[model samples]
Each structure stands twice: as structure tokens, then as C-alpha cells.
Target: MSKQRVLTHIDAAGRPVMVDVSGKAVTARQALAECRVRFPADVAAQLRKSGLRSAKGGIVDAAVIAGTMAVKRTHDLIPFCHPLPIDGIRIAIDWHGERELRIDCMVKTTHRTGVEMEALTGATVAALTVYDMCKALSHAIVIGPAKLVGKRGGKRDVGRVV
Candidate 1:
């Protein structure tokens, strides 16, 4: 058999594998991710006035709940992920500007693997929830460019864009 590159979460062979983190010491790990939603001026104005609410509930509140749920279930949704016991999850939504809404998710765990995936999933799902809530207002609403803002633990720590 031809030699193959070992994936980060895979074993020596090329076959799919979950990372063995048993030997790694448990440590506090945290990650933050962000996504931005762009809405039309009119929609933005309405949101500001109504505090981003629909008949269902508050848009931000629903998104926060969705984001937290996503964080807990990220391992189940993503392949090659080891189910983890998360310590905490927080989702924050705020207006970045007249037409932009910013969503941030922070995930915490003291485990072998970092919670980067959880944070990313939380942020993305929150943005999606926002899109769903505002779709009735206009199809022009755009969800853009989710990214990791910061991470700490493991071999390295990352900081946000300066």
C-alpha cells in the first residue's frame, strides 16, 4: 500500500480516526468566533426599534439559545469529533453599525481537545438563526464571513484581529 499523509485527527494510517487525547493533560480551553449579518437600512431601523423581535420571540434570544445548543452538539454534527463535556457557552449579539449585526460565541471546556469547533459552530448557527428571523423583512439580508476571533489552550493560543 502507498504511504499516505496522516490527518491531524487520524492515526498513522489514512483511515478515518478520532484523535486520542487520553494522554493529554486536561486544561481550561476557550475559543471565540464571530459572524456578521448585513441587513438593509429599513430592516436595520426596524430591528433597532423592535429590538430584533418576531412573533416567535426575541431574535437575539433565540439565536443565543440556538448557538448554545449547537456548541453542545458540535461533536455529533461533525465527523471525526470526540464528544466533549463543555463547561460553558455564551453567545452575544450586537449591532455593529447601521446595517451590520455582529454575533460572537465563546465556548469553554477543560478537556483534552480545544473547543474551537464548538465556538465556530455556535457563531455560525447564531448567524443562521438571525438570517431566518429576518428573512421575512427582505431577501437582501446577507450573512458573511464567520471567523475565529481568538483561542486559548493546547499547544498555542490565538488572538483576534488587531
Candidate 2:
């Protein structure tokens, strides 16, 4: 039989456990994550004309702040995440096409563990925030396909275009 891939969060006893990183050396690590928000065509046109503003306020600006906050609090949100000092976080929100907005979040830190979760959390929360702010325009807005695009300085470095 083929061996099962060991999960970092599971121990021999098959109990959940946080991965121990105490013995690992601190290194500069970074991760990039992205998510997309799709709006109805007419709604997208209205937003473009309004400079991407909602009745609440600036949609992209609010999402940026929300994403930054989510990066810092990722450990709190995900039970297995280890809290690390965030060195930097950059969030960008832009149009992918006439009807879709793309949000990318890049996070950097010097820590024993990787920051993929933090990056993914930031991007996911940012997309959610955009949907929340624009729901007044229409409830058909879709947020999805959030994923880590790249990670560096871990046991491995991976890059995926999706």
C-alpha cells in the first residue's frame, strides 16, 4: 500500500496539533494570494462611472484596510495558525475586466513559519469586504476562487497562475 502523506497538523495519535516551528530558523518569507469579485455588467458600469465608490464609501480603499487587518489577525481566525510579526502587507484591488475586480494581497515577514495562510486570509477578506460594500447595488455579486498564487522561503517555493 502506498504511504499516506503526513499532515503537519496531525500527529501519530491522529490528533490535531499545531505544527512545531520552534526549531526552525527565522527567515524572510513572503506569500501572494488573490481573489476575484464579479459584478453584474450594469452594476460594473455604474461602479466605473462612480469611481468605484459605493454609498458607504470608497470600495477599494475599505477593502485594502480590511485586508491588512485580516493579515494581522489570521492566527486568531484560523485555529492552527501561528501568530507571527508581520513585516509588511500590500493589498491591491483592480479591475480584471468590465465585470470583475481582482484583489491581490502580498504579505512579508521574518518568522519561523510560512505566511501563506495570512496572505490567503487577507485576499479572501478583502474580496468579502468589497462584496459587502457593493451589495446595495445588487445581491448577485460573486466572490470566489481565492487562492495562494505564490510562496517563498519555506521548505518549498511554489508559483501557480490560477
Q: By TM-score, who's the top model here?
A: 2
Candidate 2: list runs displaced more than 4 Å. Answer: 1-4, 160-162
Q: Candidate 2 — worst ten consecutive residues by lDDT sum?
A: 153-162
Per-residue lDDT of model 1, residues 130-157, tens digit only = 9998898889999978999999988789
Q: Please, what is the whole-model Cα lDDT of each candidate in the order they appear?
A: 0.88, 0.94
Q: Output candidate 1 Cα RMSD.
A: 4.0
Compute the lDDT for candidate 2.
Answer: 0.94
- lDDT digits (tens) for residues 1-162 of candidate 2: 986777889899999999999999899999999999999999999999999998999999999999999999999999999999999999999999899999999999999999999999999999999999999999999998998999999677899422
TM-scores, in order shown?
0.89, 0.95
TM-score of the candidate numbered 2? 0.95
lDDT score at residue 74, model 1, on the 0-100 scale: 94
